[model samples]
Target chain A: METNDKINQMNDDELNKIHSDSLGLNVPENYFFESKNRILNKVVTKEEPKTIPFYRKKTIWFAAATLTLFLGLTVCNKYAALDEQKIADQLTDSIAQIDNENGATAVSKNNFNNQIPNISLTAENDILVSSLFVEEKEVDQYITNCILEDM
Target chain B: MANESDFIDQLISETHRDNAFKKLLDLYQVRLYWHIRKLVITHENADDVLQNTFIRVYKSLANFSQQSSLYTWMYKIAYNESIRFLEQNKNKHSISIEDVNTKYLNCLLEDTFFEGDAMQLKLQTAVSELNYKQRQIFNMKYYDDLKFREIATILEMKEGTIKTLYYNAVKFIENNIEILPVKKGESVQNTENI
Candidate 1:
């Protein structure tokens, strides 16, 4: 009962019986044949080059569309931000120019009052106010002439 | 050897590969099926693993370095595929491999294809009782008659280790199983040593 004496001394004949008997493991009739065919069918199918039509690939189309939309939105957003910044900078320059013109008019009136203390003050003030409507080219020339005279 | 080399070349060649693969399936499918069947313990699982083994062999034919015999290479693939199938089932059921084997043993008891007698069933139970590696070595040695060196090569274990594990497994089965004498008139239908 300690050890199976048969296995210890089992001869080749007994071993062959084990090999030939298939260990009571049976398959359905013609199972191997059918299984071979099935395996072959699968292998052949796999071996054949798989060719999917480009038009039939929906995921690729979807990915491409998504990328295009993302890029389009990003480009539009960048340009929109740039345009807004440009308009703000233009408005800032315009306000700076208007301030400079007002400053020049005040400075010119002060200088004229100091130089012509005895002249009629009402008429001179009217002329100085009228000069405020001068074109930008004429004002630039006047500012340059004032700077040169001061130098 | 020359013939096998030629065959291997054909298996890797595009024009002749399909035909050569068909020949390979004819030669190895039954043997591989039985090997897988013993591991999985059910015809359906064996069938699935066998098909997968052949498919793997087909796909990997080009990488065959001819370092080992074609039989050995294919046997290795079949062995790995059976293990993979078992692992997948183990994971799917959220159970250990031992639990999966027990579940399969229960299935085998109810399987129509399993016609083992009481002695055969006892031997199977004893074999199942061994650890997984020991079980594999025992089956491949006892049932398939694979040499220790070949088993070592397939399992990537040292030959001495394979021998030790195999003898230990044999001892375990021998100690567990009871040997009944054959009746004078009855034929020896059960496996030897059972």
Candidate 2:
């Protein structure tokens, strides 16, 4: 074991000597320039514009077009709904005006009738009795017609 | 309010500046490259890892809190890059380290790179004999002259463990050196076996 240790030490010394001796093996003068050129070539190759895969480009275009179509449809629908609401509002306003005019005419006619109380009550009673008679007669006629039709 | 501390703080804050990056590269490139080279065992692999290490340092400079020494952080990056490179290349080679050594030996014998350099040949043999971790520890400690503390930080290991690995590696190299033939016409020295 001791001998082995000594031999190992000797080997280390010898290796160290070789290492020192081999130091500064003169690199050829153009070595660095050549290496630089090689590196530059590699860099250029890496930086060159790469053609995108067809599927990837197609997917990007498809996504963009789909997005634009969706946004356009959403905006168009929103405007269409707004226009529909405007037309509905105009119709509702016309109906409300008609109802107001009818209510006013009915109140005015009631006020005019109040100015002629005597005739108003008699006329109203006559109208009521006539409407009741007409209704009853119509019912009797309907029943007679029904009986005749059956016969 | 020491001047030196202020200067170091200013320097760290300016690490994003081109001059500061150049300074850092000059200071650390060789050391980091050698550290990486030892693990990957190829110059090209080391260069790639070294470049990646610097690029990472550049990208992460803004996040560098001077909590640890710059050397420690840089080494950690280099070490990780080296390991990653090794793992990436391991599958491509389709050979284990033992097989790699045999191939390397065959290449060395035929190649002119180490012609007439018996010491270099012997050194290669000795290094090849080490296991992966031992080679890493040995190279970092001996070749890079890194302290056990620095190695521990880089490797994310305890200093005591690094020390043990270094000792074990040295022992392995020493025992294996004798088995290797010295040079042409040299008799083998009979050394006491471990």
Candidate 3:
């Protein structure tokens, strides 16, 4: 009997009967049961019929985009407010320093107003009006007058 | 047991799907586990593949339209899952399929779940030496006790091809297994003729 012939003779039944003893492997107890639960958990997670794909939910993405834009605009507005406040603080401090230096002479409000013409204090851009109108020669003359008045 | 179509319907039916699938698991889990274990060659690997197989079966149950028997479809899935698992490992490690199969068989020796004696180890080595597809075909035919026609359906190959491979696989095993003797009339064929 050739090898092939002999093998053909040992068909499914004979082969199984002979090899079952050797190959009958074992697994941990309750492995299948616990593993089934695990599989079921995965199945439940996968089979959500009501849930839509992330890309398809355009409204949610749009809402997110709008919210992000709104937050960005608000942050920019806050920065602008802080910058304007910084300008106002610097302007107020400068004005206080000048007032302190000239406190002794006590320049009249109308005279000081006339000297620094159109000294507008506005909240829009927190600008100071010191050099808006005064020419260099006129500013030198005003400084001399103030110094003379102080003396 | 329900008839084939009834069983498939039960497996697909939402009301009866769980119960039917549980029965399917109970009926086929041990056999399928062992079948996958033989191909994959470790209890742990077998467990993973077997779970994947059943989950696939459950998911594809609705799409099953009785084109083939449920057994054939499930077996096909089990075989595919095992192949997928091995292919994944092979690709991840950049190894040939033969090298992966050898590694799996070598794993059997040190695997705690494997309680095979020396002869059993020899059997495993002999079976492992067969070509990969033949090894699976042989195991399906021999251990799983599946008919060649059913094996063909599961493997999605020609029944004749499965039969030829199985016989050749058996011959190869007979030659390799040390304890399996070439009896009085059985002679080893020449390499050229074989």
Of 1 and 3, the candidate ranking higher by TM-score = 1
For model 3, the stretches where C-alpha displacement exceeds 4 angstroms are: A1-20, A44-151, B178-194
Q: Judge candidate 1 at residue B55 and give its lDDT.
A: 88
Q: How does each model score on TM-score?
A: 0.61, 0.51, 0.59
Model 3 lDDT per residue over B1-194, tens place: 33667777777788787777766765666667777878787778888898888888888888886787777777888888988998898899898878977685678776667777777778788877887788888778656668888988887799889878877877787778755433224443421132
Listed in order, the DockQ scores are 0.22, 0.03, 0.13
Span of 10 residues, lowest total lDDT, candidate 1 chain B: B185-194
Ranking by lDDT: 1, 3, 2
**Candidate 1 per-residue lDDT over residues A57-113, each given as its tens digit:** 999999998889667755755676566657655655665566587765444433443
Residues B1-194 of candidate 2: C-alpha lDDT, one tens digit per residue: 12423434544564335545554554455556567655655455566877777777766766777666877887888888877766566567886655654464554454322342555566677776677677777778666667788888777889888888777776676676654333223333322111
- The lDDT values for all models are 0.74, 0.60, 0.70
The RMSD of every model to the true structure, in order and in angstroms, is 15.7, 22.4, 15.2
Number of clashes recorded per candidate: 0, 0, 2
Best-to-worst ranking by TM-score: 1, 3, 2
lDDT of 2 at B188: 33
TM-score of chain B of each: 0.88, 0.74, 0.87
DockQ of 2: 0.03
Give the native contact fraction of candidate 1: 0.58
Clashing pairs in 3: A1-B185, A1-B186
